[model samples]
Target: MSFKQLLYILLFFFTVSAKGSFILIPMDETTQQNHLKAYGITYWALDKQYKISWLLNYRGGSFLLPDAQEIRKECQIRGVSFEVLSDGESNSILDEISSPSQNMEAVVLERTPKIAVYTPKGKQPWDDAVTLVLTYAEIPFTPVYDEEVLSDGLLLYDWLHLHHEDFTGQYGKFFGAYKNAPWYIEQKKNAEALAAKLGYGKVSESKLA
Candidate 1:
């Protein structure tokens, strides 16, 4: 091939390779289409063994992930807004975030945290906002109640979300208004039964233990 042909070939390859090396998901209120789904995307990346950087205090704490077609497709499917940054551009952003004067840091995130929701089984607590959001985000979390907690099951998970929970065993002080509600009656019955099975005379005592 001629020298001109070789030059053109190299230029084409450089342009293609420099198009995008990083996926930047801005978490600011004005730009992000779906903030929660963006989190889902990060979780998805972590689950796939991708090491991502959380840009703390940068544009409201954005995420930096390696550019991949699969992740672009996921962001499109989940309605999460993102931007593609070339390698030089990505490095510049990181450098700005890493400066001593800037109040920002890029925290590396590699592990997918195992989440546990402390909620009573058969208590119909899944309808709550937190669980609903988690479901919508497609994030998997285990539901655990007093039974699991009493047995040291909490040690198995990395993060715990409280759902209609009361460690004091006072039923969240719902007695004044929900005392006549059938759900309230069932809740009291279940707590008492669980406490008895756990060898405690009162639910409060079981909870304290």
Candidate 2:
């Protein structure tokens, strides 16, 4: 899901002390396409130790959050679309979702999962979409290479994203067109160096291992 969608979900969680009404953050919009910013806000909420419920398949997976001034400010700052719902209205929506015919379900988010990316040490954000999103969302993640994986760094993370890497060792199928390019040559050299440093004769062998 986009970061904005995640943020909208996080903003739905309300503390018992909150006195305001419930807020509904809608995701089915085209004008204000700030989903990524919403994601950053969600990460911010997670950092503040808030719990959230994700209403799946409900109005494009809308979020039900306790209405708070801080959350309102955040929504405004991020340009996210939200509506305040009274207690009765909120409960009614929940009731509708509970109907057997509806495919909606609520998933409570308790904690943020640790994320990792399996990528080269020198790869840039322009080289990978996952990394770009993670960076934009301000989500913390570790970068692990073949050597780190071989040494069991995978145990440190609950989630992992592979970044433009080929386990089959074909160099990402770009060798035919850009084999002579400086960047390609540098990439090949880096791979070879890493493989040699890790006691592998070839980059493909190390990647496969």
Candidate 3:
């Protein structure tokens, strides 16, 4: 082939490859390698002020992120499965989703939501499941208790997890059963201490506060 023809062919291939400039994080069960880390990565990107599009009902609600080198590195580090798509391919997918016949929508997410877990700060006999999951997923959340709630500290968070909580001020109805248990006694002691700190004479009053 002529030298000029060879140069033109190479440039054509380069242009085609350069068009693939978006990352598609697939959440479908068949393709997703790590479901938990995928969510964490999305949250991480959002926290970094990167705009992400949530593809609702599309390939199990995938996430579309800008094709940044750091994002690719993050996906690899977190073991999250993803695909690279050309601009044309990405637009085609969006168009398909925009069709009324398809049960899908693209939501642009720009804000990082602040999450709070409503639970005691004192050490407990057991760990909260929601907190465990959040920890594993690498998501950060604030731990709030009755004192914080009473003081209107909840206003600082966008989402709140009840975290195996109780109401009616009965302390999970533990008085009749296992009240003498060391863990139960310690738990009650902490509750009373918190109630006192909140200027309540009784735990029930603190709960109601």
Candidate 4:
């Protein structure tokens, strides 16, 4: 059979036979091949309209997905580690999570959240590890700055990430050493301009406000 047809057939069988079963992708170091790829798989599943249960603090933040051959195939293709759990086993996991001793919790992901990163406009992914990982994993994020935040753009995103930012407005602690550096001078100028535009006397005031 053609690959497409075979995939459809396997999907049908998997959906029927694996009802109430789940695939768990643990984020522990045991998944050394590519722990990040597990997140990519979860994103892919979200794109496919699959609901995911994010098991926070469980096995180092794992994912629980309904059993599907397509998802399994994607995990294998991406080299993400996963395990299938029967209904009983899944319940046991929940039970353990409910116990007082565990720090586990769950969040249901019904849709892909809009992510925003607050960083300088001219900064590149190479300058920030979080941006690099998000870029490499094919995750989309909007880059926002002081202007955007002041304009209420922050309301548009479900998640926000900050990088290399000095909210204290001390110019990233470089004022005492690299104050004369061109890059530091530019950063200070930009921040001061923004602060002035926002009616603040100093960048630190604007940031703190």
lDDT of each: 0.90, 0.77, 0.88, 0.86
User: Which regions in candidate 2 have their CA more than 4 angstroms from the true location?
Assistant: 1-19, 30-32
Name the weakest run of 10 consecutive residues (lDDT summed) in model 2. 11-20
Model 4 lDDT per residue over 57-127, tens place:
88888899998889989888888889888888988988898788988888889888889998878888887
**Cα TM-score of candidate 3:** 0.88
Q: What TM-score goes with each of the models?
A: 0.88, 0.82, 0.88, 0.70
Question: Which is better, 1 or 3, measured by lDDT?
Answer: 1
Per-model tally of clashing residue pairs: 0, 5, 0, 0
Sum up the clashes in candidate 2. Answer: 5
Q: Candidate 2's residue-wise lDDT over 1-209, tens digit each?
A: 99998887776664433444777776656533666666666656656676655678887777677767788788787777677777888889888888999999877666778888988888886678998888875667788888889999899889999766667777777999999999999998998998899999988889878
- Tens digit of per-residue lDDT, candidate 1, span 34-151: 9999999999999999999999999889999999999999999999999999989899999999899999999999999999987777644355678888888888888887789888
Ranking by lDDT: 1, 3, 4, 2
Residue-level lDDT for 7 in candidate 1? 100
Instruction: State residue 100's C-alpha deviation in candidate 4, in Å.
Output: 7.3
After superposition, the stretches of candidate 3 with alpha carbons farther than 4 Å from their true spots are: 1-19, 123-126, 173-177
Q: What is residue 25's positional error in candidate 4, in angstroms? A: 1.0
Comparing 2 and 4 on lDDT, the stronger one: 4
